[model samples]
Target: MAFTESSLLLPSVSGTNKNKNKVPEDKWYLAYIVYFTLGLGYLLPWNAFITAVDYFSFLYPDASVDRIFAVVYMIVGLVGISLIILYSHKSDAYVRINVGLALFVVSLLVVPLLDAFYIKGRVGFYSGFYVTAGAVGLSGVADALVQGSIVGSAGELPDRYMQAVIAGTAASGVLVSALRIFTKAVYPQDASGLQKSANLYFSVSIVIVFLCMVFYNMVHKLPVMKYYKELKVEAVTANEDNGPLTGPVWRSTVWNIVRRIRWYGFGIVLIYVVTLAIFPGYITEDVHSQILKDWYPILLIAGYNVFDLVGKCLTAVYLLQNAKVAIGGCIARLLFFPLFLGCLHGPKFFRTEIPVTILTCLLGLTNGYLTSALMILIPKIVMLQHAETAGIVSVLFLVFGLAAGSVIAWFWVI
Candidate 1:
């Protein structure tokens, strides 16, 4: 089939191809923006929650709630994705995304409400934490639904759209990082101040989510986008001999995808393992600087977020064509373990801010670039009928890596 079922369903991207199938030149940018917006909406929730590590720790001081929250969020997302795979084929992509995003914004709004209603001190800290964790899980469900559907939807679209989605995910990191920097700088450095700051951050997220939902629904209505949807449906249905799979065929189709992209899956797992094992939680808790003091963790995280954006964006300029090279680079990320360890308990200079900052940037850059590359490659290599499954597989690997890395992160302080 000329258009994979995967791409056919995603918010259509603007293609420069002059072919009859491509959207016209004027509509191209609008379509691309819509697709990019979908990517932004899918990931911003996780970024907003995770980036607030310092605030979470401040609120739930006694328990290791941050680590627990991090791992649980990923695990819940893993579970959500599993559920999505079972019934996702039965649903429409447009409906799935709007509903998911609506739920996502609601989850973020709940954060401030927890702070408003609950006692701020130790008396009700655990209660507050529980509410917050529940909210995080809600966000996870939203993430899984929106992310899997959009990527799966993009299956029939151009590779650039996938790249745009990945890049948008990285952009979320950047957005959260900036929000953290702003709120922290503005708010007073006291308990009440931190609470207010965190609330303000979530408020911004609510606005973004609303805009995203509006834009997403609007994009699908565009003449060009609607035309492609009808075109793909006609094309794929005309070849019903190998049409959408049923229960027996569905199971076999997913299994075949696993076999085909097992290596890509491994690389995805390792990349997140290396990343999740040490990111905002460890970075917020473990690293310190006598010089930067409180500013140390904040700046380091921001640096990582910015560079991660840079890495994801770099692929648009030049993606390494070889999967081996990309996979090999991911394996090498294991080195960050020892390198970080050395910073914790090595030569005095290693413990300093300069070395740690440099390493953090490298970590973000490599992680961003390699992850985007793998996501882009896996779908193209798989069969058209299973492209969405392949996208889901990639997400499955991501959450597994996140869960594994979160486990490893716990051991750091133990």
Candidate 2:
């Protein structure tokens, strides 16, 4: 049987190949924008929960809010990714992504709804805290679903789309930081202000997530998207002739993909481990400025976000084609530990605000560039048919690094 049941469902490879020379236009870069928006959308939930840390911390005074949130979010995300990878052969990326978007909407609504009716700007409501934590976990699962699927999907496309996704994630950070700064500037620094700011975060995130859904649905209709998707189908038909993938065969295929991308995965892991250990936590809690007061951390975060966005965008101009050199760059990020340390316990000049701010921006710059480089490089390393699986495997490693780095943040901070 040349054409199995699965093959029958897919568009005819010969038919698709006919128009291979006539590449469909993206038309105003709509598909690119949609992918970038989806990348931004998936991370907004996590950013919303974390960015509103001030409000959550104010509400739950006894609990260590940031650390707890990190643990809950990362663990749930790790487990969710594991399950997705295990069953990826059975699932469709399109369906998984749509479901994940819906889940994001639900999770974003939880905190604001709880605040409006139950919490009501009150402090010491541990019940609400727990519910909020559950919402964070829900967002984690959503992240695993949407991020893995979309990134995997993008992996099958040209490098620019992946760059858009990476840049969009950085844009999510910048968006949240900008909102945080705006809210802080507008509202008074009090309970009412915290409540308003936090609500604004969730509300804006919700709106963007909706926009993401609309764009995501519309993207498939674009001629360019259809072209690439058909190409993927053609590639799969050519390479995977063994009919429906049985459990053993799928597992072996996954292992093969993993083996090929192990170094890339390790580089991604190391990148995040170093980054998560020092960022936001160190900037927010450890260091203080006599002049800027509470504003110091906020500004530092903004600077980091801005520089990160800059770094991610740089790849659009010039992507380092060498994977080994990029992995080496990831390893080089380890030097950031001591450099950041100098801002704390070293010489007087190093301990000043100027040095600390420079280091933070540098951290973001390196993090953004290296991460974008690695993600764009991963799919190119594997066969087109297995590119999606390879992308998902890379995400698993990224999440593991995130979880480890978050844990390390607890002890690494001075």
Lowest lDDT 10-mer window, candidate 1?
10-19
Where model 2 places Cα greater than 4 Å from the true spot, the runs are 1-18
In model 2, the clashing pairs are: none
- Global lDDT of each candidate: 0.77, 0.88
lDDT digits (tens) for residues 199-229 of candidate 1 = 7668777887788888887877777656556
Residue-by-residue lDDT tens digits, candidate 2, 64-155:
89888888988988999888888988999999999999999999999999999999999998999999999999999999999999989988
Question: Residue 29: error of model 2 in Å?
Answer: 0.9
After superposition, which runs of candidate 1 have C-alpha atoms over 4 Å from their true positions?
1-23, 26-28, 53-60, 117-125, 227-231, 412-414
Error of 1 at 114 (Å): 3.6
Model 1 residue 304 CA deviation in Å: 0.6
